[model samples]
Target: MNQRPDEDFEEDELELYEHHRILVDKGQSPVRIDKFLTEKVANATRNKVQQAIDSGTILVNGQPTKANYKIKASDEIKVLMEKPPRDTEVISENIPLDIVYEDPHLLIVNKPPGMVVHPAHGNWTGTLVNGLVYHFQHLPEMKGNVGRPGLVHRIDKDTSGLLVVAKTEEAMTPLAAQFFHHTIDRTYLALVWGEPEQDSGTIVGHVGRSAKDRKVMDVFPDGSQGKHAVTHWKVVRRLRYVTLVQCNLETGRTHQIRAHMRFLGHPLFNDAMYGGDKIRKGTQFAKYKAFVQNCFDLMPRQALHAMSLGFIHPVTKEKIYFEAPLPEDFSSVLDKWDNYVKHE
Candidate 1:
């Protein structure tokens, strides 16, 4: 995937027309264009009208047009939304941050499960953004400049582990460069549905969206849209119906570890999206089926966590390694599986 360039926008001169992006509850048709702009553009003023038109802030049918342009059906409309001005009141709150390491240039945070790395739709507030906003003051702008302020790299919401956040633009550039070049070493611990035939192996292929379904990803032939993904796995322990594996990532595609494990006929235990029928069986096939069912029922997300992280520090220019112990949920499942195997 092509990396998005950092966009710098000063908010003093321009205002975001949030109303233009909002859904009309009634879905009414062809209201006056001027009136539409006035509602969407906050704190509309007389002078702002001319400014909107002249500066090409407002558009009619995707083309720059005057303010008085009337509305019509099937006309694609857009607005040049401005970013919010920087505020310095940002400070660390009692928002429960799992800080592993912190310094002037960067911080390594052990992001807990269910906490998103950054804000998205329906998850704007109470995200890692909310935490970072409260944690640091005057954080530098990032690539996708909206709610995500300091984030350099991201892990999935359910995937708990270490993530690097940049405090200054200098650090952000190098950290992002490291990820783009695939120099960052990331290791994950995952519980999969089946045991691999081999003790250790590597899975390499081009990852792209499945042609049959947009929601699914597959290892496709060359020239696909998705990038190449490589994962090396070693069996840590084997259960009757599942396997605990440590995975090292060579390329970080979306769901690379989980998808590759599934592709290798060993989907993560609680991964409903790719679990196949193996997940629905719960613990029924296990010696301690009840224990397995309890584990799966309580854990709503994927059973994957970033276990280790090692990379050259962007600011210090020295090697840095971080590790996170498996959370209780994962440990508990392993304990039960171990006991069951011992009895068998």
Candidate 2:
């Protein structure tokens, strides 16, 4: 019989969004690992089960193993990933999408700020998935396993940028493998609160959901909690108080860039979740505060954008790239900062 998934974990190096633990019944028959897990995990497919195995995300008795491993009596199994419940279905929405590129296998869309990528608890409608469903009949799921159709990766709701969607399993499988191997190039532009001491640097740390606030993420430099995340950043331009920086994600985790920037004490401007909404730099003059407040009013969301994406075509095997210009809010806010720095 299949057992319940247990999340009983210590401060281990692994940072799985959801951890499933299974105990093989003493009378259990020997069965292939991939086929075995397909029955055990809810809302999971054989393809995903195989992907998890190939990615070394599935463990038997605490050690990564191959899909061919046979289950036995008294064996312990664990699977790690963000899991969505089986019964949930993402409803379609009439929201318009900003499609940049499309072909038989895949498409790229420039997601605007304030739109959720997928349907979740508080956000059910008006999501990118909702819009995609309206256009594409059905798309392959991503690593999140939340019915995020054709999504290779995702940006935050408040952060606007480019995203690619896979239209076929032929495109989806390889794209997922690319993201897992970190071969997909993802570049972001962010307006940070303070200047970095170094012009270019990399932030390495483990990131997990904050203990105090479940709504946001936190950096655990000690590696005691969270998953290993790496971000490389270089200053694109310095606007005196704030810096326009380009960030390259080496590993994609929940809020990796935002949390890592916060760890460096240069949170993205107007990022309320990480405390960037408050003025963390510059003078404390009444005029300065008011100016910052005005800037805040102009761009209420975090000042981050997915600037570019580069990856090999999952089907054609050809190198493909796409980019998006800064949205009006981000560009306008930067203009204000430039004017302020010039007048200073």
Best candidate, lDDT-wise?
A: 2
Q: Given candidate 1, what's the lDDT at residue 119?
A: 50
Q: Against the true structure, whose TM-score is highest?
A: 2
Q: What is candidate 1's lDDT per residue for 1-344, written digit by digit as tens?
A: 35653211100011244235433434457676667767766787646755766666666755677766666666666655443334323334447788898888998888888886655443456677678878687777655554567876677777778888888988887887777777888888988886678999999876655544433566753645566778999999888677889999887776777678877878788876666324533344554566666777666677888888788888789999999898777788788778867785
Compute each candidate's TM-score over C-alphas: 0.71, 0.75
Cα lDDT, model 1, residue 298: 62
- For model 1 the TM-score comes to 0.71
Ten consecutive residues with minimal summed lDDT in candidate 1?
A: 6-15
